[model samples]
Target chain A: MESFTIVSGTAAAIPLPNIDTDVIMPKQFLKGIDRSGLGEGAFHDLRFDAGGRERPDFILNRPGWRDAAFLVVGPNFGCGSSREHAVWGLKQRGVRALLGTSFAGIFFDNCARNGLLALTLDPATADALMEVAAGPEPARLTVDLTGCSIATADGRRWSFTIDAGRREALLHGRDHIATTLTRTGAIADFEAGHRMRTPWLP
Target chain B: MPSPEPLFPHAPDRQGPRTLYDKLLDAHTVCSLDGEERLLYVDLHVMNEYTSPQAFTGLREAGRRPWRPSAQLAVVDHVNPTAPQRTEDVADESAAGQIRYLRRNCADFGIELIDLMDPRQGIEHVVVPDLGLAQPGMTILCGDSHTTTYGAFGALGYGIGTSEVEHVLATQTVVHRRLAPMRVILDGIAGDGVGAKDLIMAVIASLGADGAAGHAVEFAGAAIRALGMEGRMTVCNMAVECGARVALIAPDAITADYVRSRPRAPSGADWERATALWARFHSDEDAHFLREVRFDAAAVRPLVTWGTSPDQAVAVDGTVPDPGTEIDPTRRRAMVRALEYMGLAPGTPVRDIAIDHAFIGSCTNARIEDLRAVAGVAKGRRVAPGVRGMIVPGSGAVRRQAEAEGIDRVLIAAGFEWRQPGCSMCLAMNDDVLPDGARCASSTNRNFEGRQGRGARTHLMSPALVAASAIAGRLCDPRDLP
Candidate 1:
């Protein structure tokens, strides 16, 4: 896990609503046994044409936004699948944060667990950020988890909210699996008692 | 952060009426980590090849094995070819690699796996519940979103990402957040030709795609009670489309009967004990629901998705919506793009839209009952020329049951192809794929753009409607037939 405190980078905007996980990481890239080199597969259809060539009109294909670290997106982004591959692909493609009005529940949770910041902002603020990112020159924004704020080069800033538990986990690169394994005794005790109460359970 | 001193061996007695979800959470809580999160125990952790590989790789990298391997069930469904011939061959090297990796990982970890060659192998959502692995008063987790289907049996089941999957594999527990409760009461009986698929589609369309977000939905009332176990599963399975993580129906005689006949179900005194516990699994009379919505089941008609999203659906007799009618600029723009992608005109009637393919399969509607319903529609009717109809059962058991009832013969005799089981053409991960720009009347869930294949158009409908559309070469309502 990578720790997150603050990151400043150019942002890209895809303003269409309901950009689901299928549109992010398509099904064709899910066959690999390991997670690596998925940056190419992130938004495969939108990034490429039928001939497998890059579509120049796509936001991520443009020169200033090709390697964007932040995404200013529309509401309900990452809606459909429970695939962690979608988050992994985004992170692999140099995406450090996503600014949206709202996100799908499971995908939002997936982003938090995988060290990607999914920020929920007011609709007006999100629209403003999208406009800023869509400009001719790349828009560089700074997201600071410690400050709970996002700011632009012009000194404009907006505050956001994140749950305390998740905030602490992200501040330090916490390994949830390692953290949970320390309570093995408690888990075993619960299982033993659970068996007695409902013995028929598998 | 709080210390781990509050860990208790048994569930604490609490006052007040509790929903089924609350009871399940209380019983499974290892400890409360925070105000919103708890270390909850998992009774069964189901897995599929597509999502389990990365988790296994993480486990191997960390030198960890599943704490309770016996409590896990792995199956190979996605990315497996669904050809009629029973061969273990997968031509796609990458997909074949995933299955091989899954088999090796399951064997090495001492976990039970229904491999591709096994007669019990099928979609995880269908195979697990059919084998009685998903029982009432239990907590189940899986890598696929449709794991909500197990909630039909009164289990608290939901989907998780690969990171959570690895955590569950390592600890047999997940750091879970409590969900707000929403109850949907369906009143009145469904009219003729309206089934569970139509009922759920109507709910999704009425509530919008994100209506149930951040909530655990409980389907209740007279209409839901009147439905059979198969119908309950259908309703719960599609609950995810409305953004619900968990969907539940309280256990009753219908659930008990379905579980009693399963191969792994308890018998004798154990069965009695299980049923007694299951009977007490319903929400209390005074249980508090954060939100409630009531619908008249009789008013629901056969629905077909007119646009890219499932909520963009309308009644079969309805016409496509014009984007000009939408006041919100963003929503109107989305509607216009969806109409473009679906190749539908705003004023065109849903029944007038022609389809090139008709698919009947997916975790949502490929059960024996669904197959039987489609068989009834295709029994004596021939598929319209130029419409390719295919039926892929949810699992090997469903395929065998359909064959025993001669459903395969009827469908095949009507110019339909009876294919082997797997998630064939639903997500198009396997050899079964719709051609680019092809429109399909499908029984599967998710009408997102390119769900069946790249640039493919899907109009989500029931098995009967799909069958009817195949016979008519368009999106025809089942009631319009005969």
Candidate 2:
């Protein structure tokens, strides 16, 4: 029910495919019912070893991407399980938006519901962006959802499209429940008509 | 152009168009059901190590036990270690505790438990169908949203919160609403190189992530029929992503064949009777749905996720879009933010993005078939330098079978790690994790922030794509390999 705008932080590039939900917020974290604290378990395997030591070679250990809020990935992002925790983890970790070639269906909905931006681009454009982002002195990609375009600090830009209804919801920070609630008048009217026609029960 | 005349023109006009919640109320007959109009006869209930402990606690607190233990199934998958077969090697005490709790709860409640050591033990979603526990014409509920995976068996499957879990445990039912039905009929044979993953991706792309919100989706047509049960599961598994309460495919010969061999399935005359019942369960030819959509299977390709949402996808060979010309500021901002997080620039080539790691394992695609697909790609091929990779099977049986087929040998020979069965690295619950700033090609789900590890950049792709990326040390199409 709450709405918030996401601001991109550092741009980190991970060009891979089939990143499943388990990797996003491993199964161990799933034990808890509360949505909070999942950020800690986000990518448990890649961050540590069998002995729980951190993997120094992982991208998250690198200084440049430590605070990255934007994730550039390959195709079929969020493909495996449909765990809303995955999205909650990402949002809690401050990832405001994701750029990939494709995504898993359930993970995509989680993103939209949580107010995260998931933008799809062609593979070629994604590759070029990864190159620029991996460079020194961090390149910035501006996500203006209301404007429906992505611009980089260097003036390069990309245009994307979304369903008008979804676009409106994102702009207004409304989820499906809120969208449905907006039709209260119609629902009330329907209930009234039903009462008159059937009138057997309250 | 002109909004394409509203995709479902007749949708609103058909009986005033009910929402999923509305349909659920009608199905349950909440208004007319006797005695407070509570839920009765739960369709399905799946439990995993992660969420079952607290549910058991709630049950005990209420001085109630499982009403119909036969309907519930529990499995230990999330916390089990992917390596070190000995249970003692489970490094995380918390996970070990949960596993123990699930085992005890199952024994106490008389619910079916697929323990780690059991040959049938595996990811709950994978093992359920593998064992024929899921069937057609059932209303299934699980603690996990991926329970929708069972929808492939022609049943309604969705996730339930812990409270609902307790409700089901005590009363064998829970309050519910029905979902408006959305029928998606695929018209043609899938072209070469396209798989169930691609088919689902195409569906999401066409409908957008929220297109099926509050609907129960029914997938029909030759394309869906042609898929094996495993393939069907992959397609239905992500129904939640499309915002549908569930996704289902009617039962058929394939379903019968798959279930007949399972240990739990009926035998001889019983099997025949069960099949008869299943046959009657299919939607009648004249059955109607609230909405209908059609697609050609031949148009789909091996897909990849370029954005955070499943609907934000493209064929593997495409490039990032330029957001400057976009009309919606919200979408434009999303694209820009996605590019930034992914370290991508506008107008960049997507194929050129490199990878540092490759992973294959998860409930979604870590079945035996998935393992075989990766093995096919990894055979006689070495992982690219600087790219670390691993393969975790969904179950102990899959692990044993892969080893029997020398798939492990091929993987290890190709420099891929062959670990034991457990949810590893996929969500970083255990010791598996990506190092800081290490970009990885993973076959698990969700490429959200820190999914692989803290600040670990993840790219979601199919198993074959993960294998291909592991070999190329970059995001390359599986079709482009070999």
Q: Which stretches of candidate 2 lie over 4 Å from their true place?
A: A1-202, B1-40, B84-86
Give TM per candidate.
Answer: 0.98, 0.69
lDDT of 1 by residue, B312-404 (tens): 999999999999999988889899999999988899988899988999999999999999999889888999999999999999999999999
Candidate 1 docking DockQ: 0.80
lDDT of 2 by residue, A76-132 (tens): 667555566777777787778888767655566567766778877777777777776
Q: Write the per-residue lDDT of candidate 1 for residues A45-105, one digit (tens) a residue.
A: 9999768999999999999999899999987888888999999999999999999988888
TM-score winner among the candidates?
1
Worst 10 residues of 1 chain B by lDDT: B4-13
Clash pairs (backbone) in predicted model 1: none
List per-prediction Cα lDDT, in the order shown: 0.90, 0.70
Residue B15 Cα positional deviation in candidate 2, in Å, after optimal superposition:
13
> Worst ten-residue run, lDDT, model 2 chain A?
A193-202
Number of backbone collisions per candidate: 0, 133
Measured against the true two-chain complex, the DockQ scores of the candidates, in the order shown, are: 0.80, 0.08
